[model samples]
Target: MAIHRSDSGRAPDTRELAKLARSARQGDTEAFLELIESLKGALYRTARTILRNDEDCADALQDTIVGAYQAIRSLREPAHVQTWLYRILINACNTILQKRQRQSLPGTLPEPAADSPVYQDVELREAIDRLEEPLRLVVVLVYLEDMRIADAAAILGISEGAAKMRLKRSKAQLRSWLAPADMGRERSS
Candidate 1:
């Protein structure tokens, strides 16, 4: 059930997605619900990586879902529904982060037990949380969501070079955060 990068390098069926988007845009509630169900896990994971709080992530996702419903009509390219949803998710997470900042909330928080593996995976999750937002988003989109660099760049509304730069930084940060002690534990099992 791990959501890691796909090695096969095949693109998803954009035609079918476009049809769904068109239907949803035309006020088809079931189509919209189906779209949400298809993307919920990835959306939640992306929000969790950015917001780093279960409650905030959930709130952000809820906001994103609502926003998407309202904004779907404005979407020019139905074929790009996935990227469109990702853009909304990022915006939602950013909004939550800004609100939390105004309230002086901590930036990074631990994942819930249900969302993480046992004690052995705690260090790995901590390493991921240690990343800055830019790097973390790239990691989540590229690795966790199995998006290619070009596609991830499109989703994040950044240049491919920027995406690559962020990925490089994220990997380096993760390696540094893992270090010897953390790596030992992760590798021992």
Candidate 2:
């Protein structure tokens, strides 16, 4: 299914994306380039949310684009391009994370640069980074990427209800973490 955003104007039209996907699947290189161009920002933002490092984000995006282009012909529905593309991206990011885990000796890698625009609010970014992968992914996909829960579920390979539940739990967790102790005591009194 084509992902419909609440703020439709921010994203390219679903019909146009599908048409591009169809042509790309038929081995039209220009169409594939256009499709990837249109989704590049969203793809980068999603990757940034997961990886937090610009270098890793770029690597993941490159890998995802190459992987998607190779597998386009196998995609059963053009309308599902966004979902399929994100699924590939998430997998690519995970692959990078796995490699990083194996290669790094705990403190070898530098901390995420605070100056990055994507991490404007350090506290919020740290809180998000602290979330478990599944919950963090749901939050990033639905909230950060402006994706519908159904679409997020499609990418995550989860039921819509499960995606919704994850989002709910993430919000609660974020709130508790962000909330002031004084605020909680005030509310109780």
| Best-matching candidate per lDDT | 2
The candidate maximizing TM-score is: 2
Which stretches in model 2 have alpha-carbon errors above 4 Å? 1-9, 106-110, 113-122, 184-189
List, residue by residue over 1-189, the lDDT tens digit for candidate 2.
233323542666778899999999999988988888888878888887778788999999999999998999998999989888999999999999999888889668655634444456888888988888799889978877778899999999999999999999999999999888698689788
Please give, for residues 102-129, the per-residue lDDT of candidate 1 as tens digits: 8785775545424542114777776776
Worst 10 residues of 2 by lDDT: 1-10
Go through the candidates in order and give each one's C-alpha lDDT. Answer: 0.77, 0.85
Model 1 poorest 10 in a row by lDDT: 1-10
Against the true structure, candidate 2 reaches a TM-score of: 0.84
Q: Give the clashing residue pairs of candidate 2, or none.
A: none
Cα misplacement distance, residue 96 of candidate 2 (Å): 1.1
lDDT of 2: 0.85
